[model samples]
Target: MNAVSAEPASAAASDLPAVHVVAAALVDADGRVLLAQRPDGKHLAGYWEFPGGKVEPGETPLQALRREIHEEIGVRVASAEPLIRIPWRYAAKRIVLDVYRVRAFDGVPHSCEGQPLKWVPASALDPSEMPEADHPVIHALVLPRHYLITPQPDADEDAFLARLDAALARGVRLVQLRAKASDDAALRRLAPACLSRVRAAGGQLLINSRSDLVDEFDLDGVHVTAAQLAALDARPVGAKRWFAASCHGPADLRRAQALGADFVVLGSVAQTASHPQQIPLGWSEFAALCDEAAVPVYALGGLVRDDLDAALAAGAQGIAGISAFW
Candidate 1:
């Protein structure tokens, strides 16, 4: 309901009624997230959304969230952190939804405002049941921020495992094993050691361009190349692996969405040593592409930990990189 409020004070601020809303993803120990139905007679009535409300004149987003959730659902937010901010437009209003992950709370949630509330498993959230502006928020809730695409491992196998360990230690929870130089036989040989390190750290690892190896290795998922993505008519059925795709532009983004990919990697947001000749999509271009994307997009090329906040501000899931992460 608060996706209608937050706007920066600027020359254009007065042009539209800016609704700076703060919302919370109240996650329970079972990994379930809470959703509340807007009471009748309100704007977008009967819509299901994260519990939050309009930010008052002086309250910060965090303050607004705690107050709103307390008032709306009768729970005191104990701990929280920023998640995603979505700028959305309605007919006569514009809203900036400042979403936060409610990691812990003090009391049981009840519909203090007489709204229906439900706790849904994170994996089971259906975007179709949510308001249009909320689809991206669902993606942010489910996917991790940093997506690691491995550089080709050095000939030293032990050294490679160490590198993977370091990346995981640095909090890279999502990984793609994109060893372009290694053939299937070599990748198969490396997989066991690589998987062992990632799995031990509780990170998800997906084989790049090799969906066929998924069951053989009992891996978490697959990342389809653009060529592979173009050839597919539908998401591979019955295998039950998470799927992501490498996407360059709007068309690729559309295809990835149509095929139901969990996410897509987009960019060369800045020039990289790996592709010295390819022009990069400056942040402006990157933001434009991301604005149209239905699925979450991870900005790739020449990005590092420092780029995370800027990437999120530009509407990215996070940054993906070879050298920066390695």
Candidate 2:
């Protein structure tokens, strides 16, 4: 996520030889992404993955990406952006996979190397069929760039709903309803209204530390607090539902990954009214944590829409905030 040098310390630490690879998620106008199957004799034969190959000596990642796309699929990358970086280890190899979203390209994609290729809907791309390293890439491809954490509902519920509707209309696609001050009955009443509005706006709603209500309200997912993350041994939600966690440090992140969390929100990256006394991680520390993270992360606390670029550059999926979002 930091776009650090291709040969970083993490790669050197591994016993296996370091291999740097660049891949492209070629997106079409209809939002489908191109995937190529590994040929019969290659490693992980028949497994599907984003089209790419090893980065040769002296080639920048962008250069390797352009070269790989043309050789594998017969297209020249016209425009692209970084998506995610994965540090992965197989039984006998180590790899640092640098992936990008190919937004614009010159020609239709075909299997130039005689490997099978298909353009599948982003949501339909199954991680189970891909190499383990590409799983996070699928998450990056399908998930939105901005996540909104809802503020506490006020005494006037109508005003809260109106404010939520406006945020949804403004393209806030992923939301977490964090009404911790409300009682169970009040939350039960509010959940449906929030879900209806979120769905109507083509977004997903996750409940804050409330896995039990997810099924009853037909919500999208649950976001667990750090305490809850520590208490759980197994993932609380089904595969179709998202399971996210709030993590403050390395231990929390390790625990969340052990529990197979879909993603995690890591921060207080900046000071905020919600927790003014607490110190922030700042961009440097945040990027350091992200370097070791296997799952997508969101930078929370005091982040505005303008911080999205900074957050992404720091290896985060996006920025999530209560005040700026709501």
Q: RMSD in angstroms, all models?
A: 6.2, 3.9
In candidate 2, what are the lDDT values of residues 1-326, reduced to their tens digit?
A: 11122222344357767688889999999999999988776767878889888899999999999998998899999999988877765544567888899989998888888989988999999877887678788888888888888888977888999999999888999999999899988898899999999999999999999899988889999999999999998999888899999999999998987798888999989998878899999999999998778788999888889999999999898988887778
Best by TM-score: 2
Q: Which stretches in model 2 have alpha-carbon errors above 4 Å?
A: 1-13
Please estimate how well model 1 matches the true structure, expressed as its whole-model Cα lDDT: 0.82
Candidate 1 C-alpha error for residue 238, in Å = 5.2
**275 Cα displacement, candidate 1 (Å):** 1.9
Candidate 1 structure quality by residue, lDDT tens digits, 1-326 = 65332233354654787678888999999999999987787767777889888999999888888999999999999998777666665555677777788978999999997889999998788866777677767878888888888878767877887888999999888888887788667888888778888888888888888778888888888999888899999885333577889988888887987787877899889988878999999899998887666567889888888999889888788888777788
Least well predicted 10-residue stretch by lDDT in candidate 1: 2-11
